[model samples]
Target: MGERISNSRVVISGMGVVAPNGIGLSDFEKALRNGISGIEFIPRLAALNFGCQVGGIPPITQEHIDACFSPLQLRNFNSDGIIYGMIAAHEAWRNAGLEPEAESLDPDTGVIFGTGTSGIEKLNESIKLVDAQKVRRLGSNVVIQTMASGVSAFIAGHIAAGNQVSTNSSACTTGTEALLMGYRHIKAGYAKRMLVGATCEHGPYLWGGFDAMRVTNYRHNDKPEQASRPLSETAGGLVPGAGAGAFVLESLEAALERGAPIIAEVLGGQINSGGQRGGGTLTAPNPEAVKSCIKDSLVMSGIEGAQIDLINGHLTATVKDPDEVAAWAAALGRDKSNFPYLQATKSLVGHCLSGSGAVELVATTLQLQRGFVHPSINSEDLHPQIAKWVPREKIPQQAIDVQLDRAIKASFGFGDVNACVVLRRYNS
Candidate 1:
């Protein structure tokens, strides 16, 4: 908390995203700008009798596969997580002007990609084959595709990452936590560039648990676009989603040396857990820990609560949304109109589960870089508690230009864990 602003600053040089609303950076940005909803009704989920049949899933094309994977790699490829991860990671790498081919592994470069549950779809496939006594027919790629570290391993090998190439899984916080972790790596001079992101698989097997738990929105099955209603009074439940988002985090000095476009500067961040105590449960966050996490993040960033201009929150369109806003207000020591402009990207993208933080962070970075705040659709009739803490106009249903010089992004996941990062416009 002392002289943190003078510490080694980390900056995002390149970004790539595979979202249900959009496929690439350009498409994603456009979708965000225009308030496009990616949540749709899946016929399979309905056929499977899932209570929540609508969800957000990216429309991946074969050309995208050909660009990211080789013919041999795709022969037995059954993991959609791998497909989304590679596409997003490769885009981030190339966006930073790095080529995929490397004559030798670079110790200064590595990856910290993450996923919550890997290859659930592939695991289901393997289970069926084994149950039918056709285990021999199971493809050799099954193991690699379903493993937790599969996404990181594939990208590390492709990029020739000689430094620490690894994976992290933290439920919904996987992505944002990875971003903070990678930033720490660069700050500690462990690596010059770390490609960090998170991907989540979709379909019946992955989302069935939530459906069974009755934590997903089933009321909007017919009106998919309106299903995910973060910060709204009528939010039934979260609409599960799947996608990937990635960024190339480079040391500020290294980015300047290489003339990489700095999208935003990571001032500092913090990751902590509430220990599932004091009203916190296996599925809910402890309010005390949530406040501390945000305060600590601000201290680490050497900034005051009042300096923050925007917030990209982990509002999953559940009963937790109001509680989350209360935590932010309490942590920042701000009330009502004094609070910074708040937004919920999940209103359009739905809750991406483990990938939610990363995709939302991408949206946050783009919002700052583009000098406009994307609309938080489906937020009409802000929940009474939330409205009491913030102005209604702050949560617009349409995009607007604003001087978003400083921002904070936070993600809270199951296990009562929280990760908060401070980002600001990289003004040289």
Candidate 2:
């Protein structure tokens, strides 16, 4: 069992994001504060057979399209994954200040990224072409392009990282799943460094599928930004958006030796599945599973709930999700008044699915770096029932006043795959 892989420290040395808020850490933060929703009005896709006129990453302009990727490169690749992975991974490597040609790191550096709803968009496009009698027009690259792991492979090539690379497709929990795997690799000494996170690209096919589930917002199509109201009374459902977030993980020792700027220490991460899989609604979460994961994660970190200063919740704009999660917190005997502060990043960036945890992870790191907490913009009135369980009124917006040092980010995937990660402020 390779010595059971025990007792090692992991740290988050760097991170990068490609959100609807656009690229660059500074610009992204501005959007977060100003509450600028990236969802826009696209005239072309608007006329398509769809129910909602909504927001999403706008169409790629010709100059940007041509400058970033070529027809040959994307010939067999999913355009959504290709665009997101390239931008996110590139920014992550640059942010780490790891010279592309650095010789200090080992060749065994690993990569494990989470991708939710991969290639569905491209698959839909190809199927449409077939229906239109454009048989010969179909490109030969369809098979490779639609592969879920295609983005991971493309990203590995860019870094010239000839090492172990893997991909996770665990719906919403995928990003945190990838990070957990990387943490294990470093702790087990299998790899000294790794790049992990998640990404998503919005497309008509994805939206249509969600619509079929009758879980998406149809009433607020005209007001795209208002479509997602996590803890609000009029909340209907999640407004699917697209973006990518990546993190560079390195052993604490390795990072200090290189003198790189460390963002936060990833103390421990744990995952748990719900009991009697079929008992819970396939698309929903379970309180037992949430409580189990939280308890187990704290045990792994060897910290009490009282030690954590913040709780970054997976508060997707839904009627039941917030209640389910708050119930779990209450079940653990966590006094709503004193346990930990709570904030939901989905309230800011919208839900990025695979990239949600990754983006929140970065957001938490920024909180630790700047000593400020981000508020769930526009959530003035939290649900009354949930307020009893979630003590904090709303995610704080002003500069952080307290000496907050540690936080937890929790994510729940579609199949009740609950993942919780703990982070500590870097004291250096």
Candidate 3:
């Protein structure tokens, strides 16, 4: 992992997003550029007496569902994560111009989809049914639907993948880690293309714990759009979100051979956990681990930190936002003036838990390809600690045109785990 493999550059050939802000690359890009707010008040949360009554959920319609699934596949499908993952995976496959229903399994292709808590809603329902002595009513697909590998399994079956289809869960770091793992497979010459992404099940069963833990914003229940204020001095807490993001990644050689549109090159990345040491816990990140993750990511990517044109932070609009900024400042060895443009995509889309990294990765790739930085909405008032570490002007509140030659996306999860990825524009 120290040296880059010759001719092993991984590039993003296609992307699909089922996010709170939008679905599909085109719509998601539009939402990002326009600074759209996807967080909304959920009456159910309010009715349930939740501390935070607002959240970000993708607005998937019946038509959208019909477009993604067949009549047979739709039957007995109780997993929201699976539904989201399928739509996103299919979108990425089609966007990459690859036919989903191949004649046979492409032995050199596979999937590495991830999820945080798989099908908790379905499991919750099943538990109640069994408690009521109605276990026989549970469908045959319940096991598959509620399993941790369900999303990846479904994607693999639908795409006819043959090489190493697997699911990975690392709290919130699942998505970025999955992408990097898929890239490693392609880089190692074990695969030609890897479908990589993550999804989180939508609903109270999945979100109630965070709400009970008082980690979500309750003040903005009356104003959902402004509730998730990442990097802002007035930021309260994270606004829980659910969705999926997918990408088709292949080696530059393979993408070129297939005449695929190169979106962004995956330079390299790092994945590690804090072991719950040095102020780290199940609920907070260790500053040292966060810093090391970034430093080693740069080393693996073979790029200087100064070369980072943009960063989509893991800032989740909580008290920890300042600590994240501080870690970034320390990791890059860049003071205020020399720092790169930093913004919180969570400011607009909220935190998608396990799906955040992949969704934000798609946004990061879009910025690289489109040569623009999406606005960091609801961060007009930067936290004093962050402003001390970064220049105010470096944070863009409106879409700005810039050559994003190199960018880094990082996700720090609940278990004090961290993952980072470096991406660069496809020059060739």
Candidate 4:
């Protein structure tokens, strides 16, 4: 880690997001500012007799699909995660002023896009064909579509990435972990620029396991918009969602030389796990580990916890919301009276699972760039335990204007894994 201090500084040059609340950066920012809810009822889930019939699926139309994929490339393309990841990656590449159709491979640019369970829908289709003795009908695209690295592989080809192109999976921590991985790659001089993000597919096939675990909200089937209630007293289980968020990370020197639009500076980050010990389980995070991860992130960033203007927390509208708040407060050594402003993107977009961390990071970057804190909608009634650690004003219910200099984003996932990143508004 000490070597990173002397290496090149990493900064975000461009960003693209396909969140349930919004598709592109402009619409995402608008949706966040306006506190629009993207969770809605799905007829397919209802027809499937799912306990939770509503979800946060991005409203991707045929036009959106056509813009990113050619007719030939779209053949037998059933992986929603790959489509979302490619769309976001292409947008990020173009946003950074790079041509995706470049004939030559970019040795200096790579990809670290990730997904939790890629192409579950495609896998299901292939299974049915194989069971029915129609193996030949599975087609040549099945392997690419159903592979866990499909998202990264597709984007790497689209951009002609000749560097380290790979995918990582750590349950819900996948996105934030991918961002940190890219940051380290540039800091270590492994690549000059890297496209980093995560994507996840939605629908019963992928979400059924969570529903069976009884971790998904089943009470809000009638009122979809109010389903995800992070930090609220009436909060239920999480509402499953899917989407992708991507960013182009390059060295500060490279970005300046190329005249790229610097979105935010990646100060530093930390990734660790609780080892499922000391009260941590496969499904729950250890409080002490979460606090240590946050504290270490600030140390790596060379900033005190007091410098954090806001905390984009991984509050997934479950019993863990209060615990997460307590962890943040403890890590920063701040009380409710002086705690930094906290925002929960999941309140509006639900839990995007593997894609949640990256999508939330995009929202964090937009707030830092545009000077505002989007409201944590559906949290009008703060959780009692959380209210004891965070003041009501610290959790704004509506958008507020503020010149944010720095922010910290943290994601906690299953398997007791955690990832935290410190970001600053680009100064130069």
- Cα TM-score of candidate 3: 0.97
lDDT of 1 by residue, 129-227 (tens): 999999999977888998999999999987888888899999998999999999998898778889999999898888999999999999999999999
Candidate 1 vs 2: which has more TM-score: 1
Against the true structure, candidate 1 has what lDDT?
0.91
lDDT of each: 0.91, 0.72, 0.90, 0.92
Q: Give the total clashing residue pairs for model 2.
A: 2
lDDT of 4 by residue, 155-274 (tens): 998899988999999999999999999999999888889999999889898898988899889999999999999999999899989899999999988899889999899999899999
* Poorest 10 consecutive residues by lDDT, candidate 1: 1-10
Regions of model 3 farther than 4 Å from truth: 1-7
What is residue 98's positional error in candidate 1, in angstroms?
Answer: 1.1
Q: Give the Å shift of residue 278 in candidate 3.
A: 1.0
Where does model 2 exceed 4 Å of error?
1-6, 41-46, 58-78, 101-106, 128-140, 275-279, 391-394, 397-403
> Which ten contiguous residues of candidate 2 have the minimum total lDDT?
58-67
Please give the lDDT score at residue 207 for candidate 2.
Answer: 65
Q: Going through the candidates in order, what is the number of backbone clashes in each?
A: 0, 2, 0, 0
The residue ranges of model 1 lying beyond 4 angstroms of the native Cα positions read: 1-7
Compare candidates 1 and 4 on lDDT and give the better one.
Answer: 4
